[model samples]
Target chain A: MFPTPIARARPSVRTIYMFGLPVSLFIWLIPLLAVMLTSIRSAGDIAAGNYWGWPQGIFLVENYMAVFQNSPIAAFILNSFKVTIPTVIGAVALSCLTGFALGVYRFKANLLIFFMFVAGNFVPFQILMVPVRDLTLKMGMYDTVTGLVLFHIAFQTGFCTLFMRNFIRALPKALIEAARVEGVSELRIFWFIVLPLMRPAIAALAVLIFTFIWNDYFWATVLVQGEHAMPVTAGLYSLNGQWIASWHLVSAGSIVAALPPVAMFFLLQRHFIAGLTLGAVK
Target chain B: MADSIAGKSYWHQNQRRIAPWIFLAPGVFMFAVYVIIPIFQSMEISLYDWDGIGEKTFIGIENYIELLDDEAFYTSLINNLLWLLFYMLAVPAGLFMSLFLNQTVFGIRLVKSLFFFPFVISQVVVGLVFAWFYDPTFGLLALIFKTFGFQPLAVLADERYVTYGIIFAGLWPQTAYCMILYLTGLNAVDPEQIEAGRLDGAKGWRMLWHVVLPQLRPATFIAVVVTVIGALRSFDLVSIMTDGGPYGSSRVLAYYMYEQALSEYGFRMGYGAAIAVVLFVIMMVYISGFLWSMYRQEREGR
Candidate 1:
């Protein structure tokens, strides 16, 4: 509305504006489009220096199959799921309780605790790197899936709590007050009254956390060592090292590693955007 | 039976006071152990000298002293400064992009999603994509350079261009993120004000500068905050694309810290901790600013 809608503009300007949209989008997504194209290129195509040209032969299925067969990529994808699903459940469940407390209560330390979570969420990951790794090693969970999952759950709780608390704060308070006046226990109030209203927040947080933990490369490298426990991001990096000149396989693996989160985003775009843009408006 | 009834009544009376603590206990415990306590631990670790697996020797401020004379440390610091500066460009770039795509044309929603596709993918993939894009022989840049009768540039292999190359790759997704934020903010803009500005003959850039931007403060603030954090957390791209290579010219503090403590480099845990502490201190400055702003908002809301 601010630029004066094209509908009211001169026919020439409107035509130009409409034509410009796809051109700009094409330029913007060129990198991804290249990779998507490269993933379907046959090894013969790559070897013949046909990097950016139309592929003479499509090997989409073959390249993807080779990625799974020739490497530990399947295990990596499974590992990603194994780590992501638990962290999502643990972090979201914990935040619901924390959010309910901070949002509903008027306790003396309410803001203090809330700010602690907020502040913790923003600290750079490097500061936590050394100690967290050491802690993981000492717990005998080093290079294990449980170790990665636990740390992710703990670290993600900070952001999830901040998100959940702010969401709960915006809800109507009349129902909560009415339920409290009826002598319902606080736990039941949270379980029955509040939790039912929080489905959207839960869904939003779940998808966001799933994407975040799924794409996590840093922790996967730091805490895990072997192919058995490595998630796809780190696994893909290591595989990149091995398949030095095999751009086709690397591109296919990259796409495979990125698929789950991309799928999640398309499936839950509304909740995902709702979660991300929470603070962008008043 | 009377005692049981009394117990139930007492619980009913005190539940309100006790409920918050019960709700907070698990989350607080986990956050403190994994996030809060480690911050202090890293600060303490910075004061010592240790390999990760062995005993730590206390040599106060020695790591910091060494960092002052270390050329790589300075290089990383400068590169980080460059990253912070260049990353701010995403804010305006995103605003421009959002304005360009703010129309209500057909299939606009799909167009917006396609534009936002980069942000949803992992940084590792972005790095890989850009690495190919900057490939000296077969890359798009090479093709463009060839068309113009210039030499192909191996961007990641040149020390001067490596950091900038990686930063440009980082900007792709970051700009997308900011664009999405602005698009959402644009949705909530008051149409009445835009109409009023049009009536006042404030059209195009004038309307944007005078009327639209003031309403976009929240979006701008969020965009700035996330971009700063994104710039600082630029380890993934550096790791994947260059590995702080071409004679370590592209190393930022985050990547350098990892190199010092982990990787195939000798595990100087204490030195790594020192580097992390420096990055942490820098981040804390912004963190405190953000928290202070939030505090003021809370007070006003109350």
Candidate 2:
């Protein structure tokens, strides 16, 4: 509403603006639209240079089925879920405790510890890549889903702790003080009081981490090498290599790879945006 | 008995202090091991020579010295700078898009979400989509080039256009991300300021430049930080779209480090660690600045 509402504009200008909405959206989503369409097209259409035209016939079922039948993408999708879910749970749970400590306590190391998480979160993955991979290998978890999950949980805790601490800090301090005056044990206060208030922060962190771990490519390639453990990002890359010019299959695989995070974002749009824009708003 | 009773009383008095550490222990331990320790370990590794599997040889700064003379190193470094520059365009582009879409209208929520659609999907998908779109023969861009009486540019295969091409694909998602940040910022912009600007005849470009943009500082700061980070982390898209092909013209330091350390180029883990250390130093410059500012803000807020 910052640039005067459309309703206040002259009728003709308003009409033009309304007309432009879908037109501009069409242009914005053209690539995605193309992929969506191509995902449903027959290989024959692509081979015949019918890339932009309506498919001669819809082969949506066959194209999608072929992506699963002819590739390890299913296992990759499973691996993505297997890695992402645990990371979300682990990171969010760990941050809740750390965030509570940093947010509630007046400990001497509070800001020091909080800043460590903040700085660690911002370090480029390459710096962490070599040693993390080596440690995972040494732990006998290399190329296993467990290795990826543990590292992701550890790395994501940095950002999540930052978010969770800020959120917890904003909660009413009196509530904790009142509980303390009543002689409630610290753990009980956390479990029975602060934990309930942290639901929104936890939801936000969960959605954000789910998308992050799902869409992750760098660590997937660095830590996991086998067919059983490759997440969809790396799996899709391998499929791209194998499929060559078969756009339909590649498009189908890409759609499959993208679906979970997309679904999570749509389902948790409010929490997702809340988490992402924590510092953007005043 | 007296000592035991005193010990119990002492533990009771200190439980408040100890509880926080107990809460922090697991998260801190994991972070130190996986994230912080590796940063120093990689730095130390950079001073030696070793394949990932071989016995380590101490050759201090030799890799860094070799990097000084490597043409590919210079190419990736220059490309990263260009990426940093080109990628900043997302901030302005996002502001413009958010301004265009800020009005109240029917189906605006859907429009906003759709506008943000690209970002929700994986970059691998985005990279693949763009690579196909820029494909020489069957691609839409190629068709346009053909219709214009010019040979289609095989962007990924061409060294000159490859980095720009990949950066453009990257911008698709990045621009959307910035738009969301600004959109949220715009929602928090004061209506009173806009009303005052309008009453004083500040409209269009003047209104945006003088009245609107100052309020968007936080959004712009975040947009720039994320963009800088995104530009430096330009690995997935490059790996997916071009694989640093056409003789590795498209390699950013991240991709090149991976290539040097792990790729079929042979596992020069020490050299890769050196490249990582360089990237880490470059990042620490920005990271520390951001932290200092945020720390100041935190103290002031307290």
Query: Which run of 10 residues does model 1 chain B get worst, by summed lDDT?
Result: B7-16
- Shift in Å, residue A107, candidate 2: 2.3
State model 2's lDDT: 0.92
Cα lDDT for residue B64, candidate 2: 98
The candidate maximizing TM-score is 1
lDDT string for model 2 (A48-121, tens) is 98998888888989999999998888888888999999999999999999999999999788999999999999
Model 2 residue runs over 4 Å out of place are: B1-8
Where does model 2 sit among the CAPRI classes? high
- Residues A1-282, candidate 1, lDDT per residue (tens digit)? 766777888999999988888898889888988898999999888889899889888888999999999999999999999999999999999999999999999999999999999988988899999999999999999999999999999999999999999999999999998988887889998999999999999999998999899989999999999999999999999999999989999999999999999999999999988888879988
Cα deviation in Å at residue A176, candidate 1? 0.8
Name the best candidate (by lDDT). Answer: 1
Off by over 4 Å in 1: none
For every model in order, the fraction of real contacts preserved is 0.78, 0.81
Best by DockQ: 1
Instruction: Please give, for residues B1-302, the per-residue lDDT of candidate 1 as tens digits.
Output: 99998999788888899999999999999999999999999999999999988799999999999999999999999999999999999999999999988888899898898898898999989999999999999999999999999999999999989999999999999999999999999999999999999899998889999999999989999999999998888899999999999899999999999999997889998999999999999998998999999999999988
